[model samples]
Target chain A: MTTKPWDLKQCIKNYSAKGIHGITIWRNVLEGQNLRDARTMLDDYNMEVVSVARGGFFPSVEEKKRQAAMDDNLWAINQAFLVRAPVLVLVCGADGRQPLEKSREQIKEGIIRILPEAKAAGVKLAIEPLHPMYAGDRSAINTLAQANQMAEEINSDFVGVAVDVYHLWWDNNLQQEILRCGKNGNLLAFHVCDWNVPTKDFLNDRGLMGDGCIDVPQIRGWVEDAGFSGYNEVEIFSHKYWATEQKEYLEKIKNAYLKFT
Target chain B: MTTKPWDLKQCIKNYSAKGIHGITIWRNVLEGQNLRDARTMLDDYNMEVVSVARGGFFPSVEEKKRQAAMDDNLWAINQAFLVRAPVLVLVCGADGRQPLEKSREQIKEGIIRILPEAKAAGVKLAIEPLHPMYAGDRSAINTLAQANQMAEEINSDFVGVAVDVYHLWWDNNLQQEILRCGKNGNLLAFHVCDWNVPTKDFLNDRGLMGDGCIDVPQIRGWVEDAGFSGYNEVEIFSHKYWATEQKEYLEKIKNAYLKFT
Candidate 1:
């Protein structure tokens, strides 16, 4: 298990040596590191890049700002290429400044704008459908079926969906969608996290894999059976884990993946 | 629109006079006034009780207490009858001290045990499927599909389901399930509440309809289209509402239901 105190280099090194596949990173981690420097860092550790942090939150009211959002997304796609990552995860933007239909249209238009850049950069953009809890301010794409609907409409090889267990565990159509995404070649990335029973805080109470009650293995089985063999990326948003030493958090992550994945 | 400190009498009185069809009660309100007295009070108010507070939490390893639980459920069913409520709402029991399968079997058995008593008392038992978040502790029946599965297994016209907006709002197949439940004549009660953004507390913090972002009228349209004609029973579980006077709460209920329902 990778320990929490480990930096990116140590994480990749340990993960690679242990036959653990790769790691997904947060945007802030790359804020100071230059794209070239980050690329070199991955090369030095002999680690694979599963995905870049993210690039989508498309909805915007001002037509002027919509261009800026698309420009930012282009930059993220370029960053994913720099890291040699195949996918740049995208969150469907919320209905913040306009009606839902207008926002949905905006999001669709924004995605179409980015598709050319994504294809040129050789990076597939993964449409990450957040739980409906985030439907108002986070993402309008709130279900796998909805995400797939957008993906089909776009009809691009560069666009797909990331199947995150934390956001999708409760979905009744999860298994069916997995098979559909798999058949349509829409399953771009796989992320794992547990849903705590009490789920104290909406944004921060995410559990470590196998620590909470979600049937993680069952979901993994469904994804695997559907032909998704990507990295089972761990992404817990636990305040408890955040408060602990990074080394311990990493160790728990490694152990949980081994146990639950 | 319902205000804080809800008044049982005024709510019933107004509902009855307006021909606003049904009433659903919480256990605290029922027990606070004593179940028997509450039933009598409701009868005097001329409101037809739609459903009882609840009868669930069946999964427990404490075999010695199983009979006690059954007896209490029997009492709840009798109360439902006394209040002239046709349905006794039930949440599938949680897994306590036993494996998930055992707990599921036990719940089925527990429901069977109470079915005779419920039938004898002329009360229909409505199985309410809670959100998957409550699968471990609150209720195991987490999906409308799952509730329908149980209803089929229970094989009784008296056993049905309560479609609570708070719990089923995020479901992808909700429209189909509502139609299916209605088709089978299994849609006994339709409870209404909003899913607050950044839901602060699972046990409380339900938003007043139209205060939150749920498409209430859309769902209401589905239920009605599927042949449901019951009252849009408002059941807010917010500490904020509980903090005010009962009269204010009743007024809010009336206003919110009028505007949102």
Candidate 2:
């Protein structure tokens, strides 16, 4: 893998040099950075920011905090606009404080509330359905089908879903969902990661391309067959990977993408 | 937790005391002693062994090993009968040297080949759908629905599935699948374990009931509501759980179950 730190500029430069046309950014990387500077960097590297880290997590106990969450999303949308990112990923937050239907309604309203800003900014919002393990805290949208349902209910081309392998590999309806997304033209972003057996940490145990058990190539084939032409952004959260030199990690990423993905 | 080694007799004795009607035995526990001796122990305790450790894992590069694997399964069925184990849990083997689909078909056939013997022995076969991370090297069956589908194909109450929370907790359609299984009279065994955030080992590293993130009681309710009045067998494969004495571990199991499940 690449031995350098996970600097977006270096990643874009490397991606561009390697003929990769797109990249995805996490929230931490975008925080406090000069948006215009990031924009200039992306233009310089000739790379497209396919998707922003995420928004959502709308369920909160405090009403002010929930509103603040929406405001934070607005800021994220603005950042996406500045960086020319086409999609803003939303993770449906889990707060089972109310009846499930009420919670669902709240989430739908949350997404609807943010859609106009996202649309005005010319940024497509992609809802990312996480694994069920994250259903309590990270996302209530736990399947591509669920995301598609939310998107349809919201009724906007500006809202769709981003499919990541780590989250969707276990679905019996995966291929069917992919076909459905493709047919609807709702597939916005494709992220790649492995599901390590005996996944140690829910938050940081994500395997790199070939290190875990997910059949990435098969999933990629489904997406491709479904007409998804986007970046296969590698997103591993392994401690070992993070501990290593980023440059080395990048090299490994390149090799793993070629060899496994 | 129980203070001594995990003896089969103690497992039976303790199981009866707690009103938990069944036990799933591991191969080590079964193999360590004579089959008749184990049966005698269960008989003495007046406890039912719900399922035997395992069978399946049919795919192999070597033909001899593959056949031997089946032979071992037949032996397991015999043992299951001896111990009054109604079901034999299968960890469907992986691709081995063949293609994934081919291996899957081979495993299906292997199961079919064993079904007659299973039926004759009055032992139902419960196919355990492992988590997708185990799809490559463990079981090809990776979803409750898939297991149900297989059961339908087999067309027998003798063939169903063992629902392990650690494996199926991440599924988005869990509620629907559990209902499907219940409706079809295919819900067989229920195993409980927690999915820790950072699962350290694929084989071990399972959490005690409530320590991990899984909404255990919620899932338990789902199962019970779905008409499964079976064993809430606590199966923790964690190094952390094993480090303590068996007595302490048993106590933890009881507490976790009473509190969470």
Candidate 3:
């Protein structure tokens, strides 16, 4: 995980050595590095740049704050373009000071504004619907249906949905919604992680696949059935794993991926 | 709240003195107390029994555990009968070892097995759909739509759904689902609480109404429009509020109920 204390280059080498096919580059990892150097390192290690880790935090109660977020996202889009990642994941923001509906509108507006730049740069924007528990502050877009609706409304080739099992495994309508998303050609990415039963931390208590209750393979089957042939991106946020040895953790992740996903 | 150290008699006296309209009795508060005495105390205070706090934990990996859960639920039903509560709220349980569909089927089976006893005792069973965050261990029924479908399939005067704004407010289809529940004559209870923006604890960080992002009054309006005329139960689990002065907290609750609900 990014919480581990590895430098960007070291992380790429470690991932490449472990036969990890791709890496989603967090913006923080690129803070002090040159984008060209980062791209060169990825190429040297045979590590495909999956996507820029995140770009969206579009909702804000203040106009100036909203403008600042868009400005940051535009920068992230450029970074993704420079790094040769095809997509920028969006954790569309929510402002507790306003209603969720208002925050949702702000997210839509923000995405529409950024779409032209993203398309011109050949970088798609993947709208990731967070879990409902994060609806208060992290994101107002908390369901696949909502993401699909937003993508449809935007109607842009560069705007689509990212299917994360952790956020969506609990919904009864997930399969149908995934089908609709794929039917509309809006499934941009597939994220894999498990939900621990006694999930201790709201954000960082994610389980590795095969260690929790999610039927990841079943959901993967649905994604493949719906014609999504993208990377099965392993996006995990875990305090426990971050504290462990990076090598051992990467090995475990590979095993879990083979066995459970 | 039940987490408070007050016994049943004292709680009733305190609630009555505060002019609280009703109390939802938890099984723990009834320990070592005579049910007749509890009912007499409610009558003496001229307070209504809103509903028994809970009755369901019906899913288990083991058959014996499942049977034991059912037995405890049947006893809870009898207790609801003795206390003159019209409904027993069900926090339908989930087993982490199995698929969610299995846990859901087991919950349905458990409910059907107990429906006759509940009907005979004249106590309605309200399936409380928890938030998806609790789907792993608390309740597999995590949407108003799922609860509505389950209740309709069960089809009895005694089976219905409890709409909790804290759990269901993030849902975009909530109003439509509530309408469907009402149309099926399955809307039984409504619980109120706000969701703190940075919810510190998953179980006990709930905010008082108007203190968090949820529009409680909006959800209440939707419930009312869907023909639910029952008591607006103030169900909150908050470590912060529990650590504060109980009298002050109860006063705040009353004000919040009047102002927001």
Candidate 4:
């Protein structure tokens, strides 16, 4: 993820100036800033915190690391509540040292441990299934179907799934999975970004809406059909974009969002 | 993918010298060489052509291009037959300009068009499902489940699925899909490689067996359990490996094969 130069306050100001209605708060952006102040800034800008930008690296081979991850997620839930973000997106982690099954089990256990806190805070924990490419170290959950299944198993109103076109666009079962999630009232968030053809970097080469092959509008249609009336969050992690003039890049994003997304 | 250095004869000699039992031939290596002579070379080295490296980029937006792809696959089938290779691995392609569904449809049609020739030539077509990262332009078939479904729908012995660890190791349904492929007698080939942790290149940063996170032996066990006793083909495309002294790399491959794979 390459967008690190802009701080939280700057991001909120830019988003509001660009007519962007919502923002997802990455945890790093909250560092050194008071949560209450961040909330105040969001209110001043009339910007909505669609979801807190991540709260799960649950899988770890080490017992201490797993406990620490759980503790960190609890902290994230509290942050999400303070920021007035209704959903906390989770990139459930994977441990390369252990079997994926074991890592998945740990993820389940971690979520269970944090679900109570999430519910108490009225901040839904949205399990965001990452792309299969990240399955080695990023996330064990790599499919909407898997996320949907997990959410259903967890069976709480506070637990749900975030449907991201960037991660899930390639899946043939995406529509069916979206429908399934929506049927179960598990669709919590929707993130949009395109998959670049010659995706240079696995983590930061995401395309703007119209720059790549992904049919974002079609996937958005599916999401909307599945009753997701939330923000079509533009979540690009592009090194190229980050290197450009931020204001000009913001204009391009707005144009792409209006014309393509 | 890396490894563009050696010719077919050199590859065979080097592999045989390193005591590598199998080699999958890329189609480019067959150019300007007599197929009969290639077969003779294989016999001389006492090495097996595991599967012809590729033969399907069937999806294209243009009708002529699609036809050309089908023709190319037919040629690949003949090459596989000439080399005494039983299978031709297909990277069924996707067109970024079109919907994945359209690309997939074209792939199915292309396979049906070529199936009769494959059967006549006694060359099985192995539909190797690529990683989802490649779904935009390389192959719409990104899951082993999709490959298995396609193989079953085809319902011919000439058509089967190639299970590659690099593409499919992350899949939650991998074991079950392997079982399904095995039960249908459609498991044509097994390719082995590891997903590098910080995989530098999406196309070529493949790790050696023990160098990365994949539990190669465990996946091998699954393949074996599913009745696949074929060559555990060491198919890696690594920039790092290719940059090294290939002989030393070959030795590393042998060691990894014996120890981890």
Top-TM-score structure, candidate number: 3
* Candidate 3 lDDT, A1-261, residue by residue in tens: 443567888789888888776888898989999999898889898889889978898999899999999999999999999999999999998998898899999999999999889999999999999999999999999999999999999998899999999999999889999999998899999999899989999999899999899999999999999999989988889989999988888889889999999
DockQ of each: 0.28, 0.22, 0.88, 0.79
Candidate 2 chain A minimal-lDDT segment of 10 residues: A95-104
Question: How would you class the docking of model 2?
Answer: incorrect
lDDT per residue (tens digit) for residues A114-162 in model 4 = 9889989999999999999998889989999999999999899999999
Whichever of 1 and 4 has more DockQ, that candidate is 4
Model 3 C-alpha lDDT versus the unseen true structure: 0.91
Tens digit of lDDT per residue, candidate 2, span B5-90? 55777777766676656677877677668888877777777767778878888877678978988999999888888877888888
Of the candidates numbered 3 and 4, which has the greater DockQ value? 3
- For residues B112-200, could you state the per-residue lDDT of candidate 3 as single tens digits? 99999999999999999999999999999999989999999999999999999999999999999999998788999998999998998
Judging by DockQ against the true structure, name the best candidate. Answer: 3
* Interface RMSD for each predicted structure: 4.0, 5.3, 0.8, 0.9
Q: What is the RMSD of candidate 4?
A: 1.7
Candidate order by decreasing TM-score: 3, 4, 1, 2
Between prediction 3 and prediction 4, which has the larger lDDT? Answer: 3
What tens-digit string does per-residue lDDT give for candidate 2 at A1-261? Answer: 122256777777777777777777877777677888888888888778878877887776668978988999898898888888888888778664432344456678888998899989999988888875565466767778888888887878898888999888767688899988888889988889787754667677787787776789999999999999877777777777778876666777888899999
